[model samples]
Target: MSMIKTIKSLPMAVAAAAVLAALPMPEGTPIFGEQTAFAQRAESNKKQSTRKVQALTADFHKKLQKAQEAIDAKNYAEGMEILDDALARKANDYERAVAWQLKAQVFYEQDDVRGTISAYEKILQFADSIPEALEIGIIYNLGQLYYSEEDFDKALEYIQRWQNRVDPTLISVSNLQFIANLHYVRNEFEECLKYIYQAIEIGNSLETVEVKESWYSIALSSHWELGQYEKVRDVLEILLINWPKPRYWTQLAGIYQELGDEQTSYSLTEAAYKQGFLDDNETQLVNVAQIQLARSAPIKCAWILEKAFKENRVEKSPKNEKILGQCYMMAYEYEKALEPLSKAAAGDEDGDLWFQIGQVQMQLGHYKDALDSFASVIKAFEKDKSEKAKEKTLSATMQRGQAFTELKRFKEAREAFKTAKRMATDRRDKRMVTQWESYLKAEEAREEMLNG
Candidate 1:
């Protein structure tokens, strides 16, 4: 009953890469409180104290400028060392704070995350009191770093806190973009839609294509997840108006499938296949056949598969063969089912296909053949070396054993049930074993009575 379909959107990494241009700061400062802080500093300073602080600030400023020059030349270690010496020297609180900010920027540029975080933490602790803008900017950068690390929880923690500090009406598109991405990463699709829509609303008022495209991307994924097929169709109609591509065809086909509109799904899928939207040429042909079969159009299904085979489009894939077998079974061509069913059973050697083959054989009145097929499936499953497989094997064995008992093969049936009892670990299987033990005893008693 699951309606899960192929993802229409790119992988998170690709989407992340694609939306980079929409992001505001990327890895830079979020705000600038330094100008206001400088104003306050000027107002509060006495002449003598201001003179001493200004001289120290001038020296630190010169050292910071030289460090920037070194950094520009790609001598990061040398630049950081010079900045370190400046911070270590006769520096007041303000100079030390600016030196830490420079140090953080240098480490961020060098992609040393831990070093950058450490320096940023120092900047926020000391500089936040003097410069609120720098504090917000540092926190925003921390959000970016956490996101890069794929740490959604920490990223949200920082970004949400930053959002709380900033005015919503004044919030930049970049901030909203990061928040939307953070929500997407956390699978909080609802929150993601809210923010992305808000960004779109804001962008529409300003008429920015950047935010419009972001809106389209969000709408596509959100509608798809919510199974709003009509909305998906409508949005895709608009998308194709601008970018008429095969991507929409496939997505629309899947959505139609979810809506139980078989003919439309079939039509769209065929169009996609013909247009080379389906890369697996043979598999796509078979998929079209499956859609027909699901619609009770087995004749159409058979024709498509036959054409696929004749054109060398079909691979000798187990999946394709299984589909072909099921198609033949539905068409009441049990004889035709034999070859594909046998091949599939051998290829997978799994319990399900074996049971399927057994069912087909039984329908054809080949009871002994059915018994053998089911037994093979049971034995193969038992030897699979997987605990879950073994559990499945036990269930298959029990079913096969019951079939044998009904066919009056009591000895084999008893043996199969006994094997199931030994292999089974689940409570349900244990109860089945107990029931079969009583059945086996009853069968033995009836045989004894007959002989007596």
Candidate 2:
């Protein structure tokens, strides 16, 4: 199967916001903070050295408060003007960082992502003056902002930086998933698998957590990109268990087929069909029927096709009709096969389908109908000079003789056998024709005795 087609079939989130939303935010912190708390705190235990807490100047504090009030009132332009004036006053690192933080809030409120990114970048320039937690949060937000901008390389860079600084145990499943998706968009399948597995593991361990469906989708797609069929199958099975959607079932079946496990593939496809998952999918329905026929479940194949035809799900084209007829014939449902076979035969220019129709009619003991089918076959091949056509014409004539014999029409049977003998180039065909002629004589004798 083409991975591109499979990828296209998967239901996945298209928005970068979905990726951002999937990440767990700090307990009370929004995904994108409008304001960073300027009050300083001690560094985390993971940090070797604690940075000194920086306090905002009383004058700058008053200015920042005024800016916050304007922003809160939705007077964004007024808020930006005050912050720009405060920054122009030659503020210290701490005061400058605080001013930029308020500026970011204004830009964010204005829905200016680029402006917000610029303000946040300025705050990072005073990284040492800001609290460690606040700095880390800014880094994480920058990654998400870059993602929203579709700058995947920068997004991965900043997110990885945040991951390096934070405690692994504190990372949420959604955060891991966000990182995994970043790797996925970068076409780094191996890296994507690493983070996705971590996310799944974390998600599984938490009793209250329900792993997001997109997490498994990423795993499945990554494994496929890496050519890991077994892992892909495993992920698909998990997805089927948790989600139980039609695409998962079909995708898992396809994986099994790629692994050369046709039996399992057929079983999955048949199960999906039984659940009516394949009903709305015309190609999948036909595929399931074909698999059934290949697996020697001709009756099931015939029934499926028959129902699909009635429901107008599958097209009633000549090729499809022939398949339906063949399925019924294979299952020894000769009476059921006759109609489709005859319809298919009528649509076909070559006499092959007509020959099949004649054979089915013979099996059903409809010798008169069989004779007519054989006549049609002969007529179809009358003008064709191909060797195969000649062979088929000869076989039809011989069957025509048998049909006449079954009807006790001894004179017509003799003529059919005679014609067959003249057309026979092979010694075996000649011998068969001679035997039919002898059978015709016995039929004549039997008929006479019965009449007496």
Which prediction has the highest TM-score against the true structure? 2
Residues 1-452, candidate 1: write the lDDT tens digits. 11111111211111111111111121332222123222332344333121112123456667876876787678988988998899878876656666676676666565566676677677666642343443554566667766766677987888887777654555656557667877887878788878877776776678553554556667778767776678888777667666667777777777777878878888889878767666555656778888778778886777777667777778767777878888888998888887887887788775778877887777776777877887787677765788767766776778677677667788888888888888878788889788987887787788779999
Count of backbone collisions in candidate 1: 2
What digit string (tens of lDDT, one per residue) describes model 2 on residues 1-452? Answer: 33223222322211211111212222442332222221111133355345674555667767877887887789988988998899989678877876777777666656677777788888889988756666766777678777767789898889889888766656667678878888899999999999989988988888987888888898999999999999999999989998999999999999999999999999999899999999999889889998988988999889999899999999887788888888988998888888887888888754888888888788878999999899999899999999999999999999999999999888888999999999999889999999888888888998899999
Question: lDDT scores for all predictions?
Answer: 0.67, 0.78
Clashes of 2: 0
Instruction: For candidate 2, give the lDDT.
Output: 0.78
| TM-score versus the correct structure, for each prediction | 0.57, 0.73
Residue 333 lDDT (model 1): 82
Query: Pairing residues by index, what is the TM-score of model 2?
Result: 0.73
At residue 264, give the lDDT of candidate 1. Answer: 87
